[model samples]
Target: MANGKSLMTGLLVGGVIGGLATILTAPSSGRDLRTQLKQNKQKLESILIQLKDDSISLKESVVKTAQESAVVLKDVTADLQKSIQTWQEEIEPHKAELQKEISQIEEKIKELEQTLNK
Candidate 1:
């Protein structure tokens, strides 16, 4: 990104230097040359102002996107935690029932083993 900015700056400077050189060599009257140079200066200033406004707009857009992304990420994280909590709540009662069933099965197995021994 820094390299791109430097390249653009170099191009603008080179263009200005070339334009000045061309104007100096042209066989126009002194007054006309001065007028043309003044016009060129105004145009360059306008381009620079527009470039600055564009940069500011781009910066604002990036910041807004980052902020929105952060909000979405936080919302997703909270929803996931809530879903986990709900699952735990729903499963706890069934877990106790399953434990009770296992204990009953173990007792039945012990009774069968004693009868077989007899």
Candidate 2:
């Protein structure tokens, strides 16, 4: 992109130099040259205006795309949070049941040890 911009700048500079050289060497009177320069300036102004409009359109398109992406990201984040919460809820009861079974096993082991000691 930088290369392309530099090339365009070089081309524009070369064209301007060539045009000035031509105008200086022309056989026309000063008044005719001034008129031609005025016309060229108007054309350049019109082109600048068109380029400005195009730049604005491009910026708007970029902004819209970013906004849409942000909305999608927000929705995806919400779904992920909800899924994590649901998984936690589903696992909690099983965890509690396992703890209860472990306690029962420990109690049976203690009872067996007491009987053997008698």
Candidate 3:
């Protein structure tokens, strides 16, 4: 987008400089010169209007793409969060059972040690 703007600016400046040089170098009468300048001005105006329309269209496309990307990102984030929550829930029962078994083993080892000491 920035490149497009820079190119457009360069074209506009170059056109103006070239037009002025051409007008100055032309060996025409005053009336013809005035008529040529008027025609050039109108042509420039038309080019500017077309450029403005093109810029507006490019901007709209960029905005629409950004909006679609944002929505997709939001959906992906939500899906990932839900998947993590589901995995946590699925693992919780096994985690609790493993903890219970560990506690029972510890109690048995302690009792065995006490019995051996006695």
Top-scoring candidate (lDDT):
3
Candidate 1: tens digits of C-alpha lDDT, residues 3-71: 759976996988789887978789999898889889888988898888889888998999999999999
lDDT of 3 by residue, 12-113 (tens): 999999998988899999999999999999999999999999889989999999999999999999999999999999999999999999999999999999
Worst 10 residues of 3 by lDDT: 1-10
> What are the candidates' C-alpha RMSDs?
4.9, 6.3, 4.5
Model 1 worst lDDT run, 10 consecutive residues: 1-10
| Cα distance off (Å), candidate 3, residue 83 | 6.3
Off by over 4 Å in 2: 1-15, 79-118
Clash pairs, model 3 backbone = none
Model 2 weakest lDDT span, ten residues long: 1-10
Which clashing pairs does model 1 show? Answer: none
Global lDDT for candidate 2? 0.86
Q: Is candidate 2 or candidate 3 better by lDDT?
A: 3
lDDT tens digits by residue: candidate 2, 59-114: 79999999999999999999999999999999999999999999999999999999
The lDDT for every candidate, in the order shown, is: 0.91, 0.86, 0.96
Global CA lDDT computed for model 3: 0.96
